[model samples]
Target: MSPRSCWIGSALAVVALAGCNNVSNEMVKMPPPAVTVAQPVEREIVHQLEFTGNTRATEAVDVRARVNGYLQKIDFEDGADVQAGDVLFVIEPAPFEAALDAAKAAQQKAEATLALANADLARTQPLVQRGASTEQELDVKKADVATAAADVASAKAALTQAELNLSYTQVKSPISGRVSRHMVDIGNLVQAEQTTLTRVEAFDPIHAYFAISESDVVELMAKSPGTSAASLKANPPTIYVGLTGEKGYPHEGKLDFAEAGIDPQSGTQMRRGIFPNADKLLVPGMFVRVRLPVGSPAPGLMVPDRAIGMDQSGEYVLVVNEKDTVERRSVKLGLRVNGMRVVNEGLEVGEWIVINGLQRARPGAPVKPERTTEIVEAKQLDASNDPAIANSGAQLSTTTPAKASATGGN
Candidate 1:
């Protein structure tokens, strides 16, 4: 081979190396992923706390026999409404009547003896003054009159007691409420205050008892300055309640009682709400869901519920920073209101939250964010439809501010 051919080969190899270097230095750049972002919706919303509880009768009484006698008649039907002083049972009155008659005869006899003794005393007074009768004899007559008078008084007292016993034969209801079935049948011997005849319970104005966690109580007190267990008596917050198989909290009541302190073992405090149960829907021992508004209405931020993401760290949202970079933010959530989740904490009102195209965004990655206004429509909150409550199998119920206000509260 010639020297010229070798030099040309070397030059071609250098040119090829220079071309490969130039090609590697040039880079292919791709545009950032596109995502839809929206600012948090600000609205006037009332924060609500929910709890589970049980219903109890406002007043419950166990009717018992007051006198020892054989039951002659049950005046009221089983499970009937009874008024105060209504005759519920009739004991055998024949014995009481005979005793009363005997007492009356004894009283009459005592009175006749006292009248005769008084006449003797009157006659003896004059004899004693005239010395016709011995002073000792007059004194004996006076002492006999006093003893007869005491016997008359004792007989009168016995007669009064007999009358009371006769009246007790007719057992009357002590309160106006629904009456339970008669436990003792007719001809059954009932003892005084020993046998339970039946049970009567007042259904209207039922009570709901629940426990509030200590942390929740503290949060409530912080939100409302004067709210405390003691203050509940003076300024009772309105309570909304719903029974099992019910939708939202349809029944409304007021906080009636609260324990003086929280229970250390359970970290909760006992609370009671009194609800009007005119329809008799609330029954004793019925499980119920309670919703209590913690504070007055205030401005709050909300986002679409779908925008929330969950991981081991808890619920979070994808945020697009001012530099158009994706960022992950951990957030605390509240009740679902108007198809949106309340941002209890960790999200600012002005911050942009990723509402759509979440898959296209990654933390610390550049993103092409498109600003959009989220449309939030207010609607009736249904317990069965909310996944947050339904999936957890919690008895807690929630309501929107509008529904809460329309239901009316104290």
Candidate 2:
């Protein structure tokens, strides 16, 4: 019980207490693991194909001068809408008029010579018949008459040609359409069938040319009969065209032509749609989107686009198995419908997928599942909702009212 013994005992007790504290700190409890959640979703997805196409006019005609002359006047304004047979240009008619007059004068001279020959033949015919003239004299007279008749016929042909040349001075439009800028100014000498006066394009029933892959054609034809282009007229597919910035479909069209053969380089088939452009909104060479419904709708698996993630590898989605374990799955995607993606492979219907909190989830980790907010019926989701569907469903709900109410109404 001395002071040194008491200090040593106090030091040992302090060391033992410190050691126990260190052991307790080393054995501290661990925190709980993070959990991810999966969602059971139902959405209608569409498989669509997109292609780039160009707008074209159904019929484009170039206006050219058929006769040689100076352009006297342009009857139609540049870019003005015109009808077929409308006069477009007028060449200087003075030259053509002069030629026509010369032809007419020649025709009159030929007619005078023909009249003289006929008179002479009448005078000699009776003499030869009454034996008052030699046979050689009658033959000579006949020859003279035939030669005069030939000259008259030649003059008549020349006159007709001259008249036709005169009419060519006034050029007219070949098709009903908007005319392009005048290629020749006034007093510009134009040649016969050589100069391009202007251009005219038919706007209504415009053409939309688009290409589809051969595979797409085969798939489409599998569903429809008369696969050949010649036979497609009976039941051709409808086409829809939309401008670059337009929201809704502006024009509806019909499939007018399909190429007889596929393009060797692109392995695609060229098809044209005829759109009724009464307003002339669609023009040639304008870029547009051409939509053609090629096949029927079918049931397909889909997942929310938000669930899809992309990295160095490609597109992937997080899937939750029945054990509530998350797994990263690589998926092949089709078209996008609503906000969901059509799954071509790598996933099945009725499987749980992780849509929300994808960044926080990892593969092989346990998660808690919750239902998604948006759920669309399988059959209700098509290219677009058909109003007939709602009508049919409502028709099924129609029934007789209560018996008392029915009797009172009657």
Number of the top TM-score candidate:
2
RMSD of each: 10.6, 9.1
Model 2 Cα lDDT, one tens digit per residue, 233-291 = 88766667778986434577777788988899999999888888888888999988766
- Tens digit per residue, CA lDDT, model 1, 110-145: 999999999999998888798899989988998999
In each prediction, how many residue pairs overlap at the backbone (N, C-alpha, C within less than 3 A)? 0, 0
lDDT of each: 0.80, 0.72
Candidate 1 residues lying further than 4 Å off, grouped into runs, are 1-39, 217-226, 229-233, 262-267, 304-307, 318-327, 337-340, 350-377, 381-410
